[model samples]
Target: MMHQMRAETGPDGATDSVVSWHIVRNADLTALCGKTLSTAAPVQDATRWTLDPDRNCHTCGALFLREAPYFPDEHTD
Candidate 1:
């Protein structure tokens, strides 16, 4: 399971960007591993740690990239 979050710039860029958080949980993982599931942490924690840790969104493996303000225009072809 994969949770997808979308961040959209607000109207006129005055307000903060709109962020949507999607939570995806896989309860069948325990059955596959023959273990019990027990945790209180956020689903992101479990996914990043136990699953894909290097696929861009993993907090621990995520590298911060500083983009320039005038990088490029979205309408550029």
Candidate 2:
């Protein structure tokens, strides 16, 4: 199956649930749903970060679900 590039990046902190996470396109800092953010936005690896449904961007999450984003380093064993 084809997958869309998704980068789960947000503020650098241990507080993952409260911070409004934005699903940006892989290699791009902008949100997948087109919500513009500052260039100084803290972007980190998806696998290394966490998210909360209630605090995340719904549009981006919906887009991500529809596209079924993939991570290259993730193994399916």
The candidate scoring highest on TM-score is 2
In terms of lDDT, model 2 sits at 0.53
Q: TM-score per candidate, in order?
A: 0.19, 0.52
Tell me how candidate 1 scores on lDDT: 0.27
Looking at model 1, the pairs that clash are: none
Across 1-77, the per-residue lDDT of candidate 1 in tens digits comes to: 33222222234331443222122234232212232222321234332232433333332122111111221343389
Which residue pairs does candidate 2 place in steric collision? Answer: none
Stretches of candidate 1 above 4 Å error? 1-25, 28-31, 39-42, 45-77
Worst 10 residues of 2 by lDDT: 1-10
Q: Rate the local accuracy (lDDT) of all candidates.
A: 0.27, 0.53
